[model samples]
Target: MPDSKYAAYQPAAPYFDLVRRALGDRVDGAHFFDLVTDETVYEVLYDVPGWPRVITGRDALMAAFRGYVGAIALESADRLVVHVADGGAVIVIEYEVRGTILASGVRYANRFCSIITIGNRKIVHWRDYMDSLAAWAALTAPRGV
Candidate 1:
């Protein structure tokens, strides 16, 4: 895994760009599909032994996601449902990510619900919920074909 943290100049995923383009024209207070950087404060509702529950700043969040993306080769990330509420201060996003684990060769797919707040074209807060048991099953499965 890479030791370096996130750089503000680094490029984000295409899915993010797509959403940004799609929503930027409509939304004023909310920033959709943008990278969470050292300036971001993100929180995950799920709690595991080793993983972080409350992510503060960009670098830590990026590192956590980097570890995940490094293990899983993402094929698609789709937002099934999106609801902009609370005067654009809170955005609820339901999405699914499909991928294959590089080391295990196992198909990995997971559903997620995220409540995010964006301001000044930056993600200020994020809360994520997902199927942790399903992820554990896929990640811990046998490695061979």
Candidate 2:
């Protein structure tokens, strides 16, 4: 059965399903741009080891994602659990990123808790939280020989 908490929200389930489907393996960075509304705003708040509070808009967000993708040869997410509140939703997901950095093979895994707010069937706000130390180590650590 579907989550009962989302029963009161008319568009949350469909919107969430759409986002999940759009993020599958065949999709790329451009797909996210298409899924999001032109006026959509995504705010990512993270306090990494060396970085302070980072707040970015749509364009900057896109660029950041692109850079990460460029650094990884392949990336996929699984173990997605969705929770729907009366007026909001949250998705807990785990992701594995595999690729070579400067010709050195490396693989990094991370878990994320994403909070999403919907308005008019579109995501009005998105805030993601993850362990920055794990990410930093993955991006900088030496790969297997």
Candidate 3:
């Protein structure tokens, strides 16, 4: 779990990297996989094609990311803002991802807010919110338009 070896794409690497640096000693892990528990729960607030509303386990989450990469090839992920609270047990992050839709070749960009809960020095749960309209626009647009 040292790297994003589990995911087909490391699109969200930059956002987590920033969080790792911000949290510093407060969090335990070198990367995304390293920071989360084996049975972590990742919940997305909105409905999407590949990503489900609720995902349990790190492997399942990575599998979902793989599905996402199939549709959207993220080029960059940044503009991260992190807030740590509850004695470092809770963390809120705001970020953005920019890329292109594989099917339509339309530019893709979206903002996200995630709330992570930690336990035993590992991320046990995550709740995510994103701009679904932006995603819809990118995915629905004509190819190379």
Query: Model 3 — which ten-residue stretch has the worst lDDT?
Result: 1-10
TM of each candidate vs. truth: 0.74, 0.60, 0.86
Best candidate (score: lDDT): 3
lDDT per residue (tens digit) for residues 1-145 in model 3: 2354645455555555665665567557787667777689999999787668999997787777777767777777788888888988898988887888888888888999999888888889889999999987887788896
lDDT of each: 0.65, 0.49, 0.77
Top TM-score: which candidate number?
A: 3
lDDT of 2: 0.49
lDDT for each residue of candidate 2 in 1-145, tens digit (9 for 90 to 100): 0445333322223334445553443223323444455565665566553333443455655555554444544433455666666544333333333334433565656666666655555455667777677677766787663
Candidates in descending TM-score order: 3, 1, 2
Off by over 4 Å in 1: 1-37, 48-50
Candidate 3 residue 45 C-alpha distance from true site, Å = 0.4
Q: lDDT-based ranking, best first?
A: 3, 1, 2
Better of 2 and 3 by lDDT: 3
lDDT of 1 by residue, 1-145 (tens): 1112333312334334434543454444322323455677777887654578887886677566666556767676786677888777677878777778788999877888888787765667878899998788788889953
For residue 134, what is the lDDT in candidate 3? 92
- Between candidates 1 and 2, the one scoring higher on lDDT is 1
